[model samples]
Target chain A: MTRDAIILAAIAGAGLLTVLLFAAGADGAPRAIAALLFLLIGPGLACVRLLRLDDPLTELALAVAVSLALETIVATALLATGSWSAGAALAALVAITLAAVAAGFARARGAGSPRA
Target chain B: MAAGVPGPARESAGQAVSSSPGPAALAMAWPVGRAPSWLLTLAPLLAALALWLAAIPAIDPDQMTDLGLIAVLPPAFYLALGLLILGFCALLGRERAGDWEPGAYIAAWIVILHGTPAIVYGSLRYAWAWKHVGIVDYIQRTGGIDPAIGYLPIYHNWPGFFGAAALLTEAAGLADALPLATWSPPFFELLFAAALLLVLRAVTGDRRLAWLGVWFFTLTNWVGQDYFSPQAITYALYLAAIGLCLWAFPARMPLAASPVGRVVIRGALLRRLAADFDRRAEWAGAASSALPDLSTVQRRGLLAMTLALLASIAVSHQLTPIVTILALFALVLLGQCRAWGLPLVMLLFTAGWMATGASSFAAEGIREVLSTLGRANENIDSNLIDASLFTPGFRIVSNAARALTAGVGLLATLGWLRRFHDGYLDLPLTLLWLAPVALLGMSSYGGEILFRVYFFALPAMAFFLAALFAPRSWRRGAASLIVVALASVVLAAGFLVAYYGHERSNYFRPGEIAAADYLARNAPAGSLIVEGSPNYPSRYHRYEQFVYVPLVAWPRGNVEASANAYSLADIEQMMADRHYAAAYLIITESQKVEMSVPGLASLEAIQGEIEASGDFAVLFRNDAATIYGLAGRQGAEP
Candidate 1:
């Protein structure tokens, strides 16, 4: 139950913070943090979690590597398909990040015995 | 153990140990015990983080040994590294945190250690990034390619990295890639760590060894290739490819004696080589029995995914694709795997891209690369001897870099000899280590091929160096782990003696940036833009709007634009030329920094010389930089 709450809260917090970053006309520090979270870390962790490696370090490393490659792949695909407007690119990344996180949560839950 | 098995069988988790020496022998390596408290172990790490964060605010870029030299990053910077080393050893002192624990812990330490210099000194260090950012800006605005650019025109050919950055910057609502450039060294260094760890884990099959390898790499890397450039991205991709190959394929060659009849070669040398290969092939076949059991479909999937990665690498950088090709070929030649198709595929992608897309560099025929071979000795000499010509203080720093290189070279050699005696040097991976050295013969790369060679060989070199601490047996105890930490910290200390020691040239003052920004706003399209030299962040945004010409392309052989001894008459003559647009000259902090070195002309002297002649007027001037307009040009008055 505690684990589930933490996960849910984290998801909510990150999502809310991202929205705030976009909506609040916030410029410097908050925006930089958001970039780190949304652009690099959160999505990276999400991908890493899905790999299901016994070694968390390997998974984390692999995830970071995958995240970079994913960026290149997603950006390339979008550019190849069209002009790749800012909105479209953001949407694609957000969707990918959210989906990966969701999938990772599911995998983590399945791996663990649910108490609640 | 067949740990590389796909998801279904991977749950077995390394239980299928075959011919890996007996457990009786391996059991002696580590003491059986619970790990020490995480909180207690990590206290030093916490302290190190605090030291780093505090050091950032305390840093005054001007206070270095020489002005702006990295030696002045504050005492806390070095303290943080020392704390990391001690903290990490404490973390590994107990044996309970699982295989990834040390990996995770060391990774954090890497972040702190590598990130400090970048943070303390703001903006990207390499002037090359300014040009790179400029190229991306051009691509963003033009939405098309123009391979006619004078410098690094090949970057125009492979536009994937720039195109990706363009999209990200636009989507993220950032001004430009400057932020990315400033933050990239630490970020990319971390990524390189991950990639190195992955590759080490795949090859060594021992997590402790892998962790040690990652630590060694973090300590020894001074090449500064971790800048915001395609090479950094390409390097990570190359590592991933090697890692993935080792993971999926797992090196299972056919036995030389049983299945295939030896084809008789006519020549004596050929026969001897074939016989030697046969014996190694037999040993490799025995080793192959330990490989993972992958379904053909899964193998195919891995192959396809890996090929896509290769294609991406080929599309991104100029030299990495060729290195990837050589490394892949080396893997096969060492009887590590039978992925003969991989090198061929990479070659095709590399050649096709160069021939059709990278035609700017490729216009002279592949002969350009081929002709440059057999000059490795010259490249090395110039790189080591000539490039070290800097200020006295900075020379001490540069020599420390050479010392660090020599030290690591010694450690790796000792490790190799030790592992070779034990008959466990990991030949396929060693081949990967040797393969990038082939690049040394290919290009001088402006007398920096030695640095490039060191960068290329770094990942593989780290793995070998790790063996010095790695036990003959796989199991590791607190004692061995302590030694490993000591090795990393010692090497890291050596690295610190010089790594950011060139901070003077690397740091860009806000004044320089502001001057560049002024030119960006004021310079007309196709204006003949001249600089003190090709350094600092000037054409970053309006890269396409100007024709860049530099005052000094020194170091003996660069084409001089002014055509005279850097004189006022030369400046007047250049300004008088009826080119498409008028000429403007910029002098930034970089040129001022470069003046401390031998060959680069003194920017201060140039400023006085031009002002004394009254042939040029200050169109723009700032605290750290200045822009000059030729006094007698048409409409020259700003």
Candidate 2:
């Protein structure tokens, strides 16, 4: 598979697993591992990889920062709107992640080449 | 060969002349061209880890001296750190040490430095961290912020970090945020190192200098702000955003021609100080030209990323966004950053947040905030922290911290001059270093503005500190190696003393945790929790359910004279207040250490007074803490 496909697959797989785990009310190590990895970097990485910033460390750092930004914004919005739900927040993040991946793939397909 | 040539030159000359080499020559020559193998270099790292693991169990927190953890930490711990430093330097000295080797070493250094406290304590160290945990717990429980909450209203006003933490905590299926808080120091330190690398690489094209800058940053950062707090996350974001600005937006305009640049250049002292401005201008232009031209799409992506970082920072921290604005403005004014509109955008976000989301805090604290404006000298003086009030050991720790700060500053000055003489004038770095100093004139930040300034300045200062020992060649000489190693060791020692030296008051024993847990579980809503000092681990769970009354708050200056002059009757009367459903007074070891300063009754003395008074009953007693309640009050004892 292409690098892009592999990245999208990982993000999608993790996001789905996170949603499922939360849905199942799973706790402890399994839930912790899946949720932390996805929440920490999944959504942000999905978006940042499309930027095609090849420097690994910079990419990783920005991914974490962006993930945190998205999480904070989503959570804060839910909070300020007085409709706070961890499940809802997680669902929003997963939706954002999948949407970002799809958008990146479509953009790449439209350009007829991967981003440099 | 010249007679006066250095030994390194002579060795190279001799090798060049010899056509046929002996075993010794082959042995010596073989490794010269090859970097050390991964196994050989990683061995020290493994050994260091082993030593640290071995040393962990031997430590007893009870035996900790005023020197803090350094007083009780086994020599193996120090040796482990030394080995890590030596291993890094050895790899760094090699001609072909690639990114992976140095990077791994720095990561290990951070683990050894920041992770040690977490491992040893096996609990969260700082009271502020616990308070942050409480905020997260509150958010997780309530699912919304209460901006007008009586306790910790400031945190409610700016709840980005807590909100994100709450999401992670609930999502991760954790019981509470205690574990997250426990390991946050190293997590944030690692992030800071990554962000610092981005910023350093943006300015200097030298890869080795950039890496060394990161290493120096790890060693010299003794400010201890890399805990579980909003400042830690926002500081990292600030660095990343500035890095993005520097890399993506090098100014096209000449520095001397900009309005602020003109004023800076026209100053007689600055003119005299930087007589090499002509050369600096030429070098800066060359550097800016050397930066790769980014495509429009990439620039847009980077700008979006910068905006995201800035927006998060604006909401997450009150102080970092302001300092970030100052930095961006300085960068623009000095013609180092071409993104003139970015600072204005950051200001708008910050001001917008202050006007809307944080209006409650702004409204309440605006007068106090305005009072500190332009009182730069008083703000700086607020950080003096009278060591005379505490134990002599803290005096030593405080002095060591001051000395290290001064030492880094002095070395940075020398390095800047040396780099300037070598035809590299780091104007952007100089401005970055000076930008946070403007904060000194803004607010004292409750006597901590100075340390925060030091924290922000240390990145650029680390760059210059590394430049002081920056290798003249790809392969460093033995003399330079020894100097760098020794300097690192000295800085690391100072770091241990300065960063971990206050563990006597910061660490909470298991018994203390148990007492706190008991209170959280048993104390009903609206219960009054009277604490000896606000230094212990309280309010981590069900924090808002009770009214907390601490005898002495920080600054200890605003405390009424009656509080200090409390008799047994006064203590009884305070805890036995009729209005509250129940009242409990608890004191812990950490509070005793904090309250041992002059003019305050020691917690032990207060405990004795309470026990002597027959009206109060002992509800809970542990080796590390004690809780007391009114003897005959209904529902007082669980």
Note the DockQ of each predicted structure.
0.23, 0.69
Interface RMSD of each: 5.2, 1.4
lDDT of 1 by residue, B235-270 (tens): 988887887777666664432321122333546786
Deviation from native of the Cα of residue A91 in model 1, angstroms: 5.7
Model 2 lDDT per residue over B24-67, tens place: 22445566456445666577788989998898898887788777
* Best-fitting candidate, scored by DockQ: 2
What C-alpha lDDT values do all the predictions have? 0.64, 0.78
| Candidate topping lDDT | 2
Q: Is the docking of candidate 2 incorrect, acceptable, medium or high quality?
A: medium
TM-score of 2: 0.91
Residue-level lDDT for A30 in candidate 2? 93
Per-residue lDDT value at B401 in model 1: 76
